[model samples]
Target: MESGPAIFAGTTFALFGAGLLLWTGARVLHREPVALGVRPSVSLISATLSGVVFLALGVWCFGRM
Candidate 1:
């Protein structure tokens, strides 16, 4: 079903996003530089955005089915 795909995609996105958030948080806590050329603040913002997006995706997926 279409809902199956949506749930799978949502779960994948959410897991990846959570992982990124945890990694970024560790980097920030350790005062380490990011792999990308982006600044710390930018990276943090990006991570936060990604986490929010994934969380929203999960909510939407569950809500739909």
Candidate 2:
């Protein structure tokens, strides 16, 4: 069985990643602001990638458990 902390961490990571992806998609599609001191396209791509990484990490954690 997984420890409580591990489960909590995995859940948090997954939820944050999902939320980030949704927010990024909504902002990009709606032409809303997404500032990161870089071009909009670059920011969008980076944010999307980060979300993917977080989601992958969360999955990895759960798999380990």
Best by lDDT: 2
**Native-referenced Cα lDDT, model 2:** 0.85
Residue 49 alpha-carbon offset, candidate 1, angstroms: 1.2
Q: Which segments of candidate 2 are over 4 A away from where they belong?
A: none
Error of 2 at 43 (Å): 0.4
| Distance from true location, Cα of 3 in model 1, Å | 2.8
Superposed Cα deviation of residue 59, candidate 1 (Å): 2.1
| Model 2 agreement with the true structure over 1-65: per-residue lDDT tens digits | 55677788888889989999999999988998666578998888889999998888888778777
For candidate 1, the TM-score is: 0.76
Error of 2 at 4 (Å): 1.2
Clash count for candidate 1 is 0
Q: After the best TM-score superposition of candidate 2, give how far the Cα of residue 8 lies from its true spot, in angstroms.
A: 0.9
The residue ranges of model 1 lying beyond 4 angstroms of the native Cα positions read: none
- lDDT (C-alpha) at residue 1 in model 1: 75
